[model samples]
Target: MDERVEAVLRDGRAPGFHGLVVMRGGEVVLERYGAGPDHRLGEPLGHVTFGRDTLHDLRSVSKSVVALLYGIALGDGLVPEPGAGLTAQFPEYRDLAEDPGKAHLTIEHALTMTLGLDWNEDAPYTSPANSEIAMELAPDRYRYVLERPVAEEAGKRWRYCGGATALLGGIIARGTGRPVEEYAAEALFGPLGITDFAWTKGGDGVASAAAGLRLRPVDLAAVGQLVLDGGRGIVP
Candidate 1:
């Protein structure tokens, strides 16, 4: 372990973090645990006890990973082109087509968060403008995102479209013949030796691609190396 990291661990303590694994250059350079895996569980768990092997939620960072996977799917012919009609892919959203403007929306717009919809990602729960809250209330998640009013033309601007990420997840699910999490495992994670991981699905069963991934520190190190190596394929 580097002196700096050790210093941080000694000074700042994390609760419920019973294990930690630190690595550099794709190697396990440091690891600490309260005790055996069993001992660490069922207790508050100590600082530095959780690490490379222990799962840590990456939160919204999952969105980036999902986007990367989406690209892979696109390259592998597992996903439709950006110009494809989202409504055409999932006919279930046929009702959205009732609005002439809604049919014009495309996957590309959602990818860039340029859906032009009236949405406030972090609006108060009481506010109808909250994109997430509006999604919940809508009859369908995809339509909820697509039907959002056109603040501008598709891809005319960029916004933090978390809703678009989730909607893309759903679209990928349909194209790949599996859930995003599972597709990731089969297409990405498993090949990289990351077998134990969980993806929290939203109310709609989409993998919340906007942000929802957990990983172990060792696995984290492996991924770090992968990126540093110029996006070398994972699990290959």
Candidate 2:
């Protein structure tokens, strides 16, 4: 371990810092894990001895994975162009299309989180006003997201919104005729040799593409390396 890194680890400055792995030139230069209790929302579940194999929730990091999958699907001609209207994939939600602002929404807007939908994740996740929690509680998650009132013109501004990712997952499933997790297993994880992982579903039974991914730190590092490789080995 580098002397500087060792000093920081010794000092215990980072609270709940469980693991760190640094890779360069396709090689791991530093790898370390610390003792800490696994936590959710500041509440400790239990003491855990961290290791390379321990699976950690990726949380919103899974959004990047979903974006990568969309890129691969696009390369395979399975997904529509970015400019394609959001409603193109779901005619069942055509009622949402009646709103002039939403009628103009496109895939790119969702990917960039510029959907301009009335979403409120600004509050702490525990708050009832959190859009994500509202989406989960909705009987129809997709509809809940799609039917949201337009707060701004699509592509005019960027806002943090997980609902966009949920819709994107639905689009990927519809386009490829497979669930997002299965599609990811075949197209992304298999190629990357990420055998042990989890992609969980939401209350609506669709894969939660916004978050809900669990992966080992090393496997997460593989994803970083793959991105640095510019889709060379993984996506053809």
Candidate 3:
């Protein structure tokens, strides 16, 4: 293991790699950090000297964290259950909800990333053509996601859609009557003893549940430990 770690340090193989941590039985067995390029939502941060305390972007890992948050909120009876109507949660988008076949959409579909919406992340995230980027640019992201042309029936097939997690975040925010970050702080981060972190928000000032989570390496591992421990801390 030491030799493998040394190879990583000596070789530039994993470009942009920042840190690694391994834990066993709730104890950290290995931890390491290295200097690397970083970014804040796409803005370059040049080369940064990383350490245990430096917070790093989790990217799509944010989706998993949002999933955890959804579970916590659901346990608190704050968010709708999986069987709840997806469009029903956002009554403001009446026109979209009334669209054919949309009424059949459920929260379970979003939770499973099988919403069947016409979504594409094939293009690079830096491009507006990407579905998630377009959603962030839209005036109302939730409306943008709901109004998309239905490409397939909900729950028919699995498709990767960051918008799904974004909807979950919206549900959590609306149900809890607080920002997603605020609820996360109280229900997740605070309970896990994670104090140094940042959740990036879009231009509309909404946290990007798709790819906005930042965490220190150790804190990220703590989240993993929580999951391994059957969510004893914050996820119920």
Give the per-residue lDDT digits (tens) of candidate 2, residues 1-236. Answer: 58877888889886677889899898888888877777532235698888888877787998999999898999899999999999766788777767676788899999999998899898776665999878877898889998888887889898999999988888889889999999999999999889998777766787678877878888899899999899875664
> What lDDT tens digits, residue by residue, belong to model 1 across residues 1-236?
46765675576553344466666666777776432232211223333344446676665667767776777788788888989875676677667766677677777876777777777777764465877656755666776776677676666778777778878888788888888998988877876788988776556666657656777656756666766776675422
lDDT of each: 0.68, 0.84, 0.92
Alpha carbon deviation, residue 197, candidate 2 (Å): 0.7
Off by over 4 Å in 3: 11-15
Please give the lDDT score at residue 230 for candidate 3.
96
Error of 1 at 45 (Å): 12
Clash count per candidate? 15, 0, 0
User: Which residue runs of candidate 2 sit more than 4 Å off their true CA positions?
Assistant: 39-44
Best by lDDT: 3
Q: Which runs in model 1 stand beyond 4 Å of their true positions?
A: 13-24, 28-49, 124-129, 133-139, 233-236
TM-score computed on alpha carbons, candidate 1: 0.77
- Tens-digit per-residue lDDT, 1-236, candidate 3: 86798797889777767998989889999897888789988989999999999989999999999999999999999999999999999999888878777999999999999999899999999998999999999999999999889998889899999999999999999999999999999999999999999999999999999999999999999999999999994787
Error of 1 at 212 (Å): 2.6
Candidate 2 at residue 15, lDDT? 64
Worst 10 residues of 2 by lDDT: 36-45
Candidate ordering by lDDT (highest first)? 3, 2, 1
lDDT of 1: 0.68
